[model samples]
Target: MSDLLRLATAGDVDDGKSTLVGRLLYDTKSVLADQLDAVTADSALSTPDLALLVDGLRSEREQGITIDVAYRYFATPRRSFVLADTPGHVQYTRNTVTGASTAQLAILLVDARKGIRGQTRRHAAVLALLGVRHLVLAVNKIDLVGYDESTFTVMAKQFAAHAAGLGYPRDAVTAIPISALRGDNVVDRGGRTSWYTGPTLLEHLESVHTAPDPDQTPLRFPVQYVIRPRSAGCPDYRGYAGQVAAGVVRCGDEVAVLPSGLRTTVAGIDTPDGRLVEAPAGQSVTLLLEHDLDVSRGDMITAADAPPALTDEFDATLCWLGDRPLRRGTRLLVKHGTRTIPAIAQELLVRLDEQALSLCGQPGELVLNDIGLVRLRTAEHVPIDDYDTSRATGSFIVIDPADGSTLAAGLVGADLPIQ
Candidate 1:
């Protein structure tokens, strides 16, 4: 199987994110004949509206703006891709977080004519906070600027400086000049950018190494379901089923059940294909314990020597998504992995001035699309890792109890004082 690459596109509104995504699909021949025909018929110009390949919503098509996250799947002979085309509107910034949270890389577009804007900085800051390590500063619409190398050079330098100020390593960022509409350097090199010698966008996407080896991290397995078979074939079957959040699990490895602090050994690891001696991260398998001592859903099975910290309260950075403002003492549901617990917004610590990459004075409340640091108090102790350590165990969502609407996305330990 070809290695899978998960990436997301982000930028200010009308910066050609959707066009870039559509161009990638079209140039790769991922779009069907019927879809291309429909897009061509809908185009105002003689050429087909490539953006229609990704902007599937009627509202998006009519407004010519993407409102929600649109995911596209395509594969090359060398690699497979899961691309998230996120909205560029400030109000829809929360959707960008949703799209980028799982991505290993982010492609941040900047219009060659307009240069870097406030929204561009805002999106970059959010991506950095979400722990996106690899960044591509795509200086798009180069054709509009007469494909000038100097224009690309200036914009690329400014973005690199800003990204460095946000704590991203200089080597972690790559700047490319492209025209998503004209298909320059997106999939096939249009050869207009002869002055630039960097690899094409598709080349970088195919070759970049982003996947972390599972064996290097500590184990984190949150039990999603406790399987108790009642069938005659397996009357005494008791298995814990969940995707390994991190690290590896072997048949005889010692494990600890979190919050309960019970120790056990893995008796067997079973998958739909049958029993296995071990399993790694990203695999969903059932584990049989040597001694069952009351394990349930929401409980975590971790490496005995490297268990996550259990805490009832912790500081977190939040991206407020609710229409209503987030204030102190507001009750909400904190959904971390498979566990949902009642939690209170204890205090609003500080708000991020995204443009400046600094903190604003402590805010009394966080309004819609606000990024801020807040302290939360949960009703029970929850196992959590630092956001920088493990994305799966350190992230959570704040949901409204009344209507079940998601209010915020939280990253644990994101608010730690800069050292």
Candidate 2:
């Protein structure tokens, strides 16, 4: 099987994100015949309206704008893709956060006529905050601008500088000029503007390096269940079952159970497929430990050599998604990995000015779709890692305890700008 690449689309409305996604699926032959036929039947133009393939909602089709995140899966000979076509409306920026949370790369679309809008900058900042290292600036509608090389060049330079300010490395960002409606530089390199030499969007998608390898990072496995089978054949089987969040775990390796600080050894690795010698990140397996400590759900199993610190209070950067404002002293639930703990919004540090790409001191409260830094106090000690070290172990969601609605997506450590 080919390696998978998780990516998302972002930018202002009418930038043709849905069209671009639909174009990709269409050109790659990933769309089904019935789906294409339905779109073709609904289309009023000479050719089939590709955007209809992704804009599935009735409201979206009527308004010709994306309001929700639409996910599409496709595969090429070299790689597989999970593409998230995120919303462009400011109110739906929270949905962009959701779509890009697990994305390894983001394609920030921009209309050639209107270079980069404020929402584009905001989405870029959010992508940076989420640790999406790779980016592709798809400058759409080049045909409307007469395929001017200067237009694409100027916009690419501006975005490159902005991405640098956001801490993206030089090679992490790529610029491609294309007309999503015309299918230029999308799947294949059409003979339009021979001035451009960059790879097509599909080629780039197939070859670019993806997110960091979880198996190479520190071990972080939060036990979801303590498997104790009472069957007649195996009466003494006690294994901790959960997905490996990061790093690799091998049988006989020394491990540490968090919150209790108990040391143990991995006696064996169990899987439904049969016993295994080792398991890497992203694998769901049962770990049989040498010592049966009081490990349970919410307890973390980590490599003994480098275990996370137990903490009740920690600073985090929040992408507030709540409909209501997030004020200090508000009680919330912090769901990290397999554990959920009661926490309070102890302090609001600063809010990000996405357009200005700067911090706005300390805000009284974080409003809807606000990205801010805050301090949180948990009711119990939880093992947490910095997002830079482990994306799985360092990220969490803030839930409204009253209604259980998710309020914000949080990164364990703040990625703040230098004042």
Candidate 3:
């Protein structure tokens, strides 16, 4: 409860995911009566259409389940939360990945009556690969299963086995028995599951901390825009504006500006409201240097001691999300932070084996939602770090210059040279 938490709910269809979220919002007083009334009518009684609690779209209301990722915000007296309620259908699996991408904690729901399912495994793999540190397995619909201790214990063990296969640390997984429909063990310790001793779903969520300072590996700030103050009061103001990709940056620190390889010292750091002595990852502050340099929007600002290498060749993992198959010689635009470069898919090394949890030697082409290791060649040099070290600088997205839709998310590889 000390800091804000970001979490996503994922599971198979009809697992009471929407209901659980609705329960959280309702018990926390985050939902209004008018909305509750509409849900009641939609359900034809007190047993409201719980899916409507999250699938706010009218079309989704007609269908009675989520089709796209639905975002909801709620706050308790102790902590604030941003919840991403992802769809359960297989076709909308991408929605789960999209939701889990930014989540620090993943709430994976299972039907107490049904136990664990394949969708659970798939979602768990994505969460693990994306570096989600905290995972909560919410076994919903416990009341339907008569609040049986065996039911919960069995499902928890089954889930733990599969999660272990995914390479998630054993201590990272926590399972809680819940009845989303009856509001049992959601925000409060409901009486139905009194035999089970564990914190409520909300309690676990409030305690999980997932603030990642990936920028701590090194100071790397990709300039999004160059601000030139031609205003009357500050006509001489020239600065670069962007979020720090990694590391802490302070005024007077020796810094390097790429790709011209110019060295300079930080004269000042300023935000729109005022000047600052330092800035770190997640801060969108502007930087003013001691000397005027030819830094532009695509340039990178990095720490002098350890900086990302400017390179045109690299190995990366690409999860293809487009309709077209990615093969060698395919041209795409790689966008890392604010830098975009024309890149070619040199090779598709191995197709991810989700079932075996191993990479295969050969695959024709990566299809939609397929994750694979890949080799790429860029037209211009872009400084980057491995995704594990600096998420801000290490990640990139491939785009089709033809239509501009996002195709794949990339992570820097060990093969890339460090400057």
Candidate 4:
């Protein structure tokens, strides 16, 4: 396994995303002594509110709200971390979506005094929708609540009830009562709490198993580049260059290239040095086919034994993130796997009211951060598995054509009906 795990920190404004991140880094000794002194000095100059060092934005620094994503890197002996500090404001929900798109785990901060607010509910619902497996509800600012165990228990239970209703596993979340300002229950267990003796926030991150399942479905290789030999020694060579997306491709495995249903046998797996015995997901290499085949970009190579659903029109759950509300006839760019194609939003469906966690009436235009189902017809047939089945290949982003900004993100083939 690679030594890095991607994690995103999210919450409403002033929920301690920056301070929690700062505390995690500081307690793990990831920050330097000189930097600590500088932060200390900065804290002294401020109005005793310079706790959020991860708020790198000057505007956020002045306004005391996280406006952009701040990334911090730290590690323990067992695991390494790349924490994406996403914005808490409702306007920046698109940024949060981008940050959490690749995250295996999310560290969602909540104010201990306030418990779960509307923003907290919204962020949690978003993370759950995005398929984030693990959730660490850092009940920050515990010092403000007198480090009360009853307060922590009540908050955890309240949030747990809602999260369980969302179909998240009972044990998927681990709540840690912490005070990012006082450095309690973050790295070292807070001294004031004898009632709580669980792992610290840093400890949980260092020990969680947050990797995707090994490609157990079908072998998929999206052909990115075609390599043709130019020498007399190797005259007849047709190779497809790209990383494997899922399953495993062996030297003699029968494979079918998508969008054409052309069958071919893998002759060899080629690397810069030489041939590889096999290739799996994340291995960037070239495939030499036993027979000459016409392959190019936007073409997917799948296992002959098992194939993905080849369809032109499909339903998907989308989170609209564009400033200009989505209207009918809005042609956009759809990126699936390594394929980019022209697509048009066919329907508005319904706008999800996140504050109430339910669907409202029909919406003509999908505003910012509205999660709903959308119908998109592509220019060509694309092979996509269910998002619940294959997240790597079933998810796509919709980009606006006029201004060239990403408008929404979607997950295909979900069984749960759009609410």
Ranking by TM-score: 2, 1, 3, 4
Candidate 4, overall lDDT?
0.81
lDDT of each: 0.91, 0.92, 0.83, 0.81
Task: Indicate the TM-score of model 1.
Answer: 0.94
lDDT of 3 by residue, 1-419 (tens): 45688889999887878878888888898888899888788775557766678978888777778888989999987788899999888767777878887888999998888878777876776777777788899998888888899999999998887778777678889999988877788888989777888889888887765665543487888898999977799988999999987788899999999888889999999997899999877899999989999999988999888888789998887767788889888999999888889999988787766655666765778887777788899999989888777767888989998999888877777221101
- Model 2 spans with C-alpha error above 4 angstroms: 211-216, 417-419
Model 1 score (lDDT): 0.91
Question: Which tens-of-lDDT digit does each residue in 1-419 have in candidate 1?
Answer: 38988999999989999999999999989999998999999989899888888899999999999999999999899999999999999889889999999898999999999999998988888888887889999999999999999999999999998998888888899999999999999988878889989989999999898776555678899999999988999988999999999889999999999889999999999999999999988999999999968999999999999999999999999989999999999999999988999999999999987777777767989998778999999999999998878888989999999999999999998852221
Candidate with better TM-score, 1 vs 4: 1
Query: After best superposition, candidate 2 residue 32: deviation in angstroms?
Result: 2.5
Clash counts per candidate, in order, are: 0, 0, 3, 0
Q: Residue 97's C-alpha lDDT in candidate 1?
A: 97
Top lDDT hit = 2
Badly placed stretches (over 4 Å) of model 3 are 33-43, 47-50, 209-215, 414-419
Q: Write out the backbone clash pairs for model 4.
A: none
The ten-residue window of minimal lDDT in model 3 covers 410-419
lDDT of 4 by residue, 64-108 (tens): 778888888888887888889999888898888888987889988
Measured against the true structure, the TM-scores of the candidates, in listed sequence, are 0.94, 0.94, 0.91, 0.89
